[model samples]
Target: MNRAINCHVGCRCSHLTIEVSHGSYRNFTQRFVKAVVNTYKDLIEWPKNEHRVAEIKNGFMYGEGRNAWGLPAVGALDGKNFVIESETVHAEDWRDCKGNFSMKLMAVCDDKSKFTYISAGNSGRSHDAAAFNLSEIATVAMENHGEYFPLDGYILADSAYPLSHYIIVPYPASEVLGRSGGASAKKKFNKIHSSTRKAVERAFGILVSGRRFVSKHIYIKDTGDIVGIIIAYYILHNLCIEMNDPVLEEDNDETSNVDVARPDSFIQSVNSTAYQNGRIRRHSINPYFPSQQ
Candidate 1:
């Protein structure tokens, strides 16, 4: 426990480096993390029960004013890239947009900055939209589209995602440019979206800051092991939030840049199944309105 706490408190400390260099501590941390994560699987679940989802949505509405476009938003989704240094069979697969070897972790968090859903192990080379399309959350959202948000509630996502009833993205500036009042409404919506979405960034910051193993480039060889460790961290992260653990302040200026989600051309075609489904799904939901509405 002390070692894990120490790792969280000061991941870059010389003491940890020395212990890790000696071999035993590294093995110990791996076993310890795995044991704890496996033991507490119940704490980390996605698209929680209806009652829990409602409670989480209420928290978002309370913290971020009930804006019409995102009033019933229960979670914010974002992807984070973790650098890895060891060579693997699929090294090229893990190469990211930033030209680094990495693994992409797509996560959705509530207002409290706790990860409600995290899908890890996607090749960093995969675009955020592509990764999300293949994620379990997307499958669940589609399967229970009506039940997920009967009253127009949706998860907040960036523009990389196709806008649908289950997910909301800010209006593209170009779509509203040169029209009177269009720009103002677009600006207002973006502000609300950005503010609400910042919670995910904060959650990423807290995770990176607290996990020494992740704060530095992970020197593991097996992709599976690397992924397992990351899953453990996500579980631990949520546990911290549940316990009301004090968050260590991160150096905001040093945070890694969020990769721009590239729009998948195939999915964007109007005739494509994805685009058509998205349009149809969006129409099925009640129109979103600002809190005042």
Candidate 2:
């Protein structure tokens, strides 16, 4: 792969490829190096976040994991883990709570299962909301991009995220349903929500499956760079899906429930909760497409 990229740059084909030397990778082309470095500087340094923010502006609608915004859509947020040899005593202890105490990557995904925004590693023990609350996605979205996708609405999530005007979380405990509010909420869910918000699962599955990212053989001085490489893999994965590529393999980690998301239970609780709450109601405003609707 390195040889291909290197040779592509070296031979100077009309195909126009750019490379960026980051972390351990170097020796692409001068154009590639400068382009990638500038891109990296923009994303991580320049304005503190130009790459992902610009990506969202170009096509990565923050809340819509679908074709674009204003369509049937929902973004899914979840954390991904990578086990490298531990970091510093302080940082190591932070991630170390996970038995392996390895580094973790948290990200928000579009419905198509592409990363819309990613957060750098927090301790493996950090909660989803804690990581989310500190993220730059919302702040960046709020920047000047006229007529942009509304950062003003809700997105479906597993019970892990907090329910708010901009986010929807499943019933905390299904048992709480069967009461008046519970039954009503379940009815609303039937009308406007579903358990098949499956993009996050598919994304993680592809990462661990195709990239084979679950093993541990990495030596680490800076595991964050390794995390970036994994994310780059996902970008290529999404690009493959976008390019309509039919060549890909299923994730072999069928038994690896590292995410611990229970979509079945989540949906079941929505229904059960409505049964307990009151009467079911229809969605006044749908978030899906006409076909999906």
Candidate 3:
């Protein structure tokens, strides 16, 4: 089983060497992915307790440097689009901004680039903010912010995400580019936020570049199987980190860039309590950033 998994994930023409027929090889791969994902699903969950949360926060705070942003961030959040063959049902929904048929995998990862949580199988046409808002983590966080994100812990995200008390996003381009007095400080804050939030992007990069199966356009017909394969990759990604496996360099130049597509317009509702509180929270931290001369 292990050999089959390794061969399938690591090689493009894995069926050729597996000794099994092509159909059998495909079935085995699917079954293996499903089993692995089901068995190790806990490996990709949010922090269970306050102590675990603190540990993740400490890692993010001191991993790159001493309290890199002076914020208690447990992880970084982002979305990654996996290219797929055209689907028969809802095919247009699977088309992304780049005109490719794909599915989006929304994920969060710690400073060490290990995936802590993931919500897969969303259509690629969905925006990052919309996908995140509909995610289980978002619902949980909104219902009980203290349970999963205790001690004021939050995750860093890009401007493509909605700013919430538990999800810190960068200042909008308008705010940072304005001629106002605090513009420089906001810009500085954005720069630091981007640097810290890139861990999620790196995690996606590692997943795609590390596995041959992930980098190619997945030809699977069933969306559930595609989701299972994605989850399996994330599970194995964390396992590799635990086992201290060296991350493979990107052999394909096209896969080197892993940034998600940003929406043309992001409207934050000021009437929402979460949005107001998020703004206040960001304001409280913005002044701490020293403005450039």
lDDT of 3: 0.74
Clashing pairs in 3: none
lDDT of 1 by residue, 103-163 (tens): 8889988878888788888888888888988997678766776665544457888777766
What 10-residue stretch in candidate 1 is worst by lDDT? Answer: 284-293
Q: Is candidate 1 or candidate 2 better by lDDT?
A: 1
lDDT of 3 by residue, 1-293 (tens): 43444354534455556555546766888888878978887788787588888888777656764445544588898888888888997789799999999999899998788899899989999988889888987877667876777777778887678777777787776676666658878777776677777677777777777676767577667788788888998999998888988875534433323333233244455226776677778776664455322
Candidates in descending lDDT order = 3, 1, 2
- Clashing residue pairs in candidate 1, if any? 68-289, 68-290
TM-score of each: 0.78, 0.57, 0.84
Candidate 3: regions farther than 4 A off: 1-19, 64-70, 178-181, 250-266, 287-293
Alpha-carbon local distance difference test for all models: 0.68, 0.47, 0.74
Q: Top model by lDDT, which number?
A: 3
Question: What are the per-residue Cα lDDT tens digits for candidate 2 across 236-266?
Answer: 6656666767645446553224223334454
Best candidate according to TM-score: 3
Per-candidate Cα RMSD to the true structure, in Å, reads 4.9, 10.4, 4.3
Runs with alpha carbons beyond 4 Å of true place in candidate 1: 1-23, 64-70, 146-152, 253-267, 270-293
How far residue 288's Cα lies from its native spot in candidate 3, in Å, is: 2.9
